[model samples]
Target: MATKTAARASVESNRNDDDEPESIPAPGAKRHHFLDPRRATGRLFVATAVGIVATCFAPVHLDWRIRAVLGWDTGALCLLVLAWNILVRSCPNETQRRAGAEDPGRNLIWAVTVLASLFSLFAAVFVLRKVRAWTGFEGQLWTGLALLAVVLSWLVTHTLYTFRYAHLYYRGGRADGLDFPKDQKPADIDFAYFAFTIGMCFQVSDVVVSCTRVRRAVLVHSLISFVYNTTILSLALNVAFNLLGDG
Candidate 1:
């Protein structure tokens, strides 16, 4: 009877082990359906496309207030989607955690990054063209709004990069690469701090990066920020010249 009980226990343990899911789910397996990263990326992409079209082709005579409202709403929506992607959808499905190379949403995020960069580029061009034809108080208001829009676009791009960094860190089991304070695993907000510091200062502030991929990401982010800041500076000079001419 004792031997039989021992055999039964062994069989139960084996059954439990067999019931456990894999550390990485195979491709095409059903995973988390809530706030799926792919779906979120698609939403952000469509919203950005709409914003770009509106900024480029909207009626030239549209009221400034209406344009401001639309721009603000669009910027806010893009930001919201990105934040959601970072907070809720940043992690891979349970089974994919060990399959580090199979991160499902990275490519989509890259597409968003490219499109976001275009949005800011178009915004800068729009401001440059629109400023040339207007002067005085109306000119100042348009210039201010245009600058704000460009800044907003820059913010969106950096925020997306923040999410990208977070995805990379966590996908690697939060093990190496970035060394956070107290040797703790970094969270989404920590990644934001890291990414924005690069955007603002064009260099890493406190965190130490030992991973090659993260360093590459930081390099790309800094380059983009530098370009964006230079564009804003040029816009400022253009606005100053236009206003002086009006005076």
Candidate 2:
């Protein structure tokens, strides 16, 4: 009977060591989730920018038709990204694993995202021609500029996700080590993260503007961007905390 009991204990120990993907942590283990600015904006920027391009380039007779086919009207894709950030929240062990090896692949993701943001910004400018011709608004040029910047607003929503990813995955991890002190004069983190922050700001602003234009309503856009902008501000504060914590 004692032998059987010992065997059972050993089996349970081994089983506990195996990784259970998508499973919640066992009882008594605490998990921490932080607000990430990057994540909040990531989905908003990527999806909105992509949606705009589709709207401009699709063979459909009208831009609205393209939006219909892409299902871009409801911001479904951005919402999925927001959900993904929640799902990928890390436990302590997973956080440690992220610190062990750098994922170079993320560099490509950042680069592509940055370029896409720029292209969308320019495209918004190019579309000014149409807005001026179509609308008798008093300030057509200014409105076009503002609308061009809406994707940045939309992207701002996910900056929380991005910054949280940085906190959990990069704080004392690989990129954290490369980052400059946030407190020091002209201080900064890794170039990739730095670029990511700047790009996200623009991306988010673009989204906010774009969505507001699409809905022609401020209540939803304002409420959402308000949440996202708060995250972006928090991310700035976190960069300082991360630097201090690492020290």
Candidate 3:
């Protein structure tokens, strides 16, 4: 009986984890119907992720570069989905306590976030410079305005979510110990801070370039500004989608 019980629990856990955020039915609910909007949106996210992976690598004979817009979009969408999953789902009551009682997944998530932010700054200064050479800004005023709007929106979303999460946490935590309706993971805060960092760096670089007469320094400033602005542009559309969600 114990073995059968364990086996059943394992199956249930797998089923829960396998279902998409939008596709998961409410408790005691019947199976979802075909043409379900929620299921389709869930599938859409999966397909977007698959597209990112496929486009990132080219056939041996082909020379195609990764699509920056698609990649950044998938990333931002994945964050919202993750936030939804953790916020809305339930965890098993009887988790096997690890030695030292550490949450490895939480640690890894934060570490990767910090590292990604750091890398964004460095990559802005060098890796994306080549991209700018290919697609020059060309004084597109509308494009510049759009990019600034994106950064501002990200900042607002991040701040609001962080505040809400903190309130939930301080209220003796939630039933599942970490989740609450409409609450987000700490990683969102890190990403928000990352977006803010990118914006500040871009503005500072602009000022430095305008004030300095050094040609080399100006070139470097241009690279930083271009990369920071482009990252914001790449991520803006998908990040905007979060504001439209119910959670």
Candidate 3 — what's its lDDT?
Answer: 0.35
- Could you estimate the TM-score for every candidate? 0.63, 0.33, 0.29
Score each candidate by Cα lDDT: 0.61, 0.38, 0.35
For model 1, state the Cα shift of residue 170 in Å.
Answer: 1.1
* Residue-level lDDT tens digits of model 3 in 117-227: 443333232223333333334323222333333443343333223323222222222222233224433333432333343344532221121111123322333354455
Runs with alpha carbons beyond 4 Å of true place in candidate 1: 1-77, 80-106, 135-141, 172-174, 244-247
Deviation in Å, model 3, residue 30 alpha carbon: 18
Per-residue lDDT value at 118 in model 3: 40
Q: Which candidate has the top score in TM-score?
A: 1
Which is superior by TM-score, 1 or 3? 1
Give lDDT tens digits, candidate 2, residues 1-247. 9999999999886554332212232333233332232233344466656667755665565455223334342343454455345435644344334322222233433543344344434434434334334444424433333343435434433343333333322332322222244422111122223334433343322222222121222233234345444643344344335434444
TM-score between model 3 and native? 0.29
Candidate RMSDs in Å, in order, are: 10.7, 18.1, 17.9
The best-first sequence of candidates by TM-score reads 1, 2, 3
Residue-wise C-alpha lDDT for candidate 1, range 128-176, written one tens digit per residue: 6777787668777666766666667667667777656754555533345
